[model samples]
Target: MSWVILIVSGVLEAVWATALGKSEGFTKLWPTVILGVALVASMGGLALAMRDISTGTAYAVWVGIGAALTVAYAMIFGGEPTSIVKVLLLLGLVGCVVGLKLVDTSH
Candidate 1:
């Protein structure tokens, strides 16, 4: 359950990150609202997950998921450049996240 929440929080991180980019320094109304909401939700979920998961592992996983998704989103829709190296790097981040989960002995 905590893992689930953590994963969701990580996704929310991506949501907030993307929304922030669209917020235009908080001048935009809708995107700013979305960013605020998603930021709070993501942090809340992260805090909840930390009740069960180790801080370091949880943080790493959260960052990994958020970063990978954010870059993927940008590349896919926001005119960010794409290349094999970027893909491989994202894959490596995912691999590290998975490895952390596998090696985690605590619940």
Candidate 2:
């Protein structure tokens, strides 16, 4: 359950990241609001998960998931250039994140 919460928080990190980009320095009302909400929720979830998971492992997994999803979202919708190399890198990030989960000893 902690892992599940952590994963969701990671995804929310992506949401907040995207929202922040869309906020145009917080000038946009909706995106700014979304960013605030998502940011708080994501952090809250991360804190909750940290109660069960080691801090280092939880943080690494959270960051890994967020970073991978953020780049993927940008490539797909934010006019970011996409290439074979970028796709491969994202795959690698995901692989590393999965590796962390598999090797976690606190379960």
Candidate 3:
């Protein structure tokens, strides 16, 4: 389904994002490779999903998922500081994403 592809793409976006940060300006071979692979897959999936999903909603959802997961991963494993405010903000972003999905009437 398009939604499934879009969600996977969003997750790949996060993977590429995290890999980029770990790549050290492309100096790290493995991370850089991972970034490239994930980036391509993410973009490809996005294009595929766009056939069914509105561009604006799809893009916003992809970005929201990628951003939330990236920051959450950093906070959990990359030594980034975590706070209640940040958690709430992430939850709000997730809620907004879900709301968009629920309100989609283009069936």
Candidate RMSDs in order: 0.5, 0.7, 0.6
In order, the Cα lDDT scores of the candidates are 0.97, 0.94, 0.94
- Number of colliding residue pairs in each model: 0, 0, 0
Scored by lDDT, the top model is 1
In the range 22-102, model 2's lDDT, one tens digit per residue, is 999999999999999999999999999999889998999999999999999999999999999999999998899889888
lDDT (Cα, tens digit) per residue for candidate 1, span 28-99: 999999999999999999999999999999999999999999999999999999999999999999999999
**Candidate 1, 26: how far from true, in Å?**
0.4
Candidate number with the higher lDDT (1 or 3) = 1
Worst 10 residues of 3 by lDDT: 98-107
Candidate 1 vs candidate 2: which has greater lDDT? 1
**Predicted structure with the largest TM-score when compared to the true one:** 1
- Flag regions of model 1 displaced more than 4 Å: none
Position 107, candidate 1: lDDT? 75
